[model samples]
Target: MYFTIRPARPADVHGILTADIAAGRTSPADAERFAAGISAAVADPARLVVVAEAHDDANAEGGTGVVGWAKTHHWDYADGPAPAGHYLGGVTVRPEFRRKGLAAQLTEARLHWMWERVEFAWYVVNAHNEASLALHRRWGFREVARGARFHTVAFDGGEGVLLSAARPQA
Candidate 1:
């Protein structure tokens, strides 16, 4: 449960992919595309990709590696409510690392980052993903809209809900 959150680096791409696969959010066949996306996010100033690395003393190198990751994208609101703002997506934690609060930590970090850059931000969760929906609500995100037919890299024609939160008062 002891982990550090930081801006993602290119070196963390593999670990991110590993976690995604371990969590059943992605497949090995998508590694190439996922790597490309990670690389692009690392280089894009408008995007925020962060990784949580836990201490791994067993490794011969005696270092930490990525166990979870979350990223935000500049969304134009072409499909959901709100004009244009940052959209939180691609949040995943390794199966073994679940229930340790790492997801909340990563989300808070991204929210803080978005707060300084945008007046509002959005998050999307599958309608069936109760835990995520509850977590977002706990972070002050309110449901703005729900789509009966939603499609994404990980899901197709599924129920999705859009949630929005404003920048916290100073």
Candidate 2:
């Protein structure tokens, strides 16, 4: 299965937003805001947003589009582990696209992009998200801390654990 993975463009926003909602990540309203944010990040070199566009099927680029996406924050010292730390979240794949290795491919691409410049990369996952926890583990991320997620659109009083890994070279 071949896919053209690259930083997202504004034209891909609508499709990406649709997949995000279908993946149960956000409501239509939230998807709109999320798309805007992702577009902005993709335009900024310091930030990262990778999308996987399937190439084999005729309906590949439309309808059930944008198989998956990975968003990484630029160095945010206050919200991260170090001065040059990066944080990733909102990693999602369409329900039909799950278990297809799309998420892992997107994740590796994003991590490779940041490894050259960042000291560490980290993400927080809901404790109950077994798939995500397993994925992170496979990618070499380890649990470092835990904290309450004070706000969430899906759940009330949810808590998540911080998982981090040093760049392979470092």
Tens-place lDDT digits, model 1, residues 1-170: 37888998888888888888889988899889988988899889999999988875575353457889999887554653434668887679988888999999999999999999888878777788988888888768988877763224233667778778988788
Winner by lDDT? 1
Model 1 TM-score, all chains together = 0.87
Highest TM-score: which candidate? 1
Report the lDDT tens digits of candidate 2 across residue range 39-73.
Answer: 88878888788888776666656534587887887
Which stretch of 10 consecutive residues in model 1 shows the poorest summed lDDT?
148-157
Residue 21, candidate 1: alpha-carbon lDDT: 86
Misplaced by over 4 Å in model 2 are: 57-65, 79-84, 150-156
Question: Which clashing pairs does model 1 show?
Answer: none
Query: All candidates: CA RMSD in angstroms?
Result: 2.6, 3.4
Q: Which stretches of candidate 1 lie over 4 Å from their true place?
A: 56-62, 80-82, 149-157
Residue 147, model 2: lDDT of 66
